[model samples]
Target: MRVLAFLDGTLGDPSQPYVRVDNTGVLRGDGIFETVLVVDGKPRELGPHLDRLAKSAAMLDLPEPDLELWEQAAQQVIDNWEGSSEIAVKLVATRGSEGDPDAEPFGYALGMEIDEKVKRARTEGIGVVTLDRGFGPDVAERAPWLLLGAKTLSYAVNLAALREAGRRGADDVIFTATDGSVLEGPTSTVLVAKGRTLYTPPPTVGILPGTTQRSVFRAAEAAGWTVKMEPVPGGELAMADGVFLASSVRKVTRVHTLDGVALADSTAVHAELCEAYEAQYA
Candidate 1:
């Protein structure tokens, strides 16, 4: 792994310990993050990822992100990374130490090789289980403090959901609202296809707006696929022509089964979308 840290406009060595033990980001998970894909040493969709990071930071009342500084850090890490065809460049910002409320936010960028498991899942597809997120679709609108749309570091619940899916013998999880509306995966966005029309839950459903999914939708649209943003019921996956989970690191992965029930074959559609997605990076 290659890393660069930005501490008050100063770049620090990533391998060295910079974060204090009292940082609230570690203690309370009061932080935000974005994982970007870097191909051939260029970070893909960097502007959008930075924009989303700013939004997440704003939600947490953390210091405004200096995009220029982050860009420098990311570039440093990417330039130093070697021996990998692709890398995952992660940008993270945390609320500073607990005792010093006026301290600047801690921020860093890390570059590492993409996980083999994620690559394998993209190549061979995966099985998923539906899990309740314990919140309704309208919760984000009703309660803003839960930070439903922010990509904060408080991910224990999401990790727990994934573990539960593993225990059920599935590769991933699709979170549903208490009312049974499809939300998204723990680390990915959900998309279902019916013929040429592709459907994904709207951000109003309290799921993070997926940068990779947005890119895939743009590519899918150019390829003559109709894209729709609406509420998807948990039962709709079984009836759809195909289903997929999309994210930056995982790219586009086909869902072979949902809750042990086989979904419609998505081989052709998956191939087309994957081609379109990779074309953007090229």
Candidate 2:
């Protein structure tokens, strides 16, 4: 995937050499970001993404982003980018270059790229495993610092977890609490099918509130399927009728296997949810 980035108000050409590096976001990973799906040149679930970004900024005590400026820049990027069928737009606001770790500034970047694999995963569910790494509930509650629920740029652990999951013959990994309750996936939200209801861990349970999951729940309700937000034990995850991961980029992906345990054929409900979601967005 070739990515195009807008640095401040300047557009850097792909053929150009030597892009300036800013230490604020590059060295310390001191920033918050939001990734939205760009379908037909329009962002999907933009409001939710922005809301989450604001929440994260507040958690970090970063300067609040001017939503009006962000919206304008996002629309400008979408207008300039070509082939918008299945594209990802990432909006990032960071503290500009500075030498002090305690200082903050107002600077941001806009990035756009086209990814087809994420779309494919939605149609065909992904294989996942349970990773033994994640912030414990107590630690997260006490000194979150920057890891609890904020989508900060410090994603080294997330990348490591994904690598470990791949080594275990899985496409993704879901983190479990110290007590073995399901938390969430590396970059997605975990949703399971229990009887005729769809269940996902609540935001209070330490998982990012997935915009796609929220939309799926609404669609499920319209389709006559009950949706509930509650805590799910990791052991009982295997007993679910079906398992799926939700994200803005991947949309909704059913999980055919969780830690080598194959879930039942959920193609029917999966299709129903996908269809409803697409229709609603369309």
Candidate 3:
């Protein structure tokens, strides 16, 4: 079932048309959003996701979000949910309508079912291909205009990359910077394991600070494993004892193959991390 809640404190049927076409989110793509996990009616890591949404708004020069309004909207949808399983909630805000400077930002929270493929990734893992993101490791410092940290609605490039990945006969893509350093996936963050240690690229590398990745780090540490936030070289993808992509709804998924080459067996590390992560939420 589809559910929606508006910023003006009104709940609407998500299947019906509500968002006007004149909004900048439709015309010029001036908006930000967060897709969060709702399991058994409770939103996990919701506070951090809200905080990140605010940061994204500030980066886009958009008006500050009314977090209370957004939170209530989310709760409204959760309350309306018809199932007791895991669901995805997208919190969104656009720069209002076009040709109206005085218009306040338009915002809402939408609830939808998770994709079957995403659910499958949790158990069967995924095959990924590496693609160049056409930027360097210094992108954050050299080109702050990119706003790579924000989860904006201008996702045409990300969507195109996924299409390219599909054409390449892979389920996903891992982007590498111009400097040949590993960056992140189109919709997830990269995590590598070596022995009992875990590593992920730092935020300074122009990647979004992943909320799920952070939780996974804490989970790993709690399990007596070392966690490091550092630059990951592209070559290390193959050499690492285990490689995984981390996301909110999908949680953690091992990279079964990279460019058609089988990855090192990560079952031990995968299970330990998953156990710790689920326990953290439980």
| TM-score winner | 3
Candidate 3 per-residue lDDT over residues 220-242, each given as its tens digit:
99989999999999999999989
For model 3, what is the C-alpha lDDT against the true structure? 0.91
Between candidates 2 and 3, which one is better according to lDDT? 3
| Candidate 1 residue-wise lDDT, 129-232, digit = tens | 99999999999988979999999999999999999999999999999999998999999999899889999999998999999999999999988899999999
Report the Cα lDDT for residue 35, model 2.
84
Lowest summed-lDDT stretch of 10 residues in model 1?
A: 2-11
List candidate 2 stretches off by more than 4 Å: 1-10, 14-22, 100-111
Task: Provide the lDDT at 166 for model 3.
Answer: 94
State the C-alpha lDDT per candidate.
0.89, 0.77, 0.91
Q: Model 3: which residue pairs collide?
A: none
TM-scores, all models, native as reference: 0.96, 0.90, 0.98
Candidate 1 lDDT for residue 180: 92
Better of 1 and 3 by lDDT: 3
lDDT of 2 by residue, 192-282 (tens): 9877899998877667888889999999899889999988888777888878898888888888888887878888878878898889877
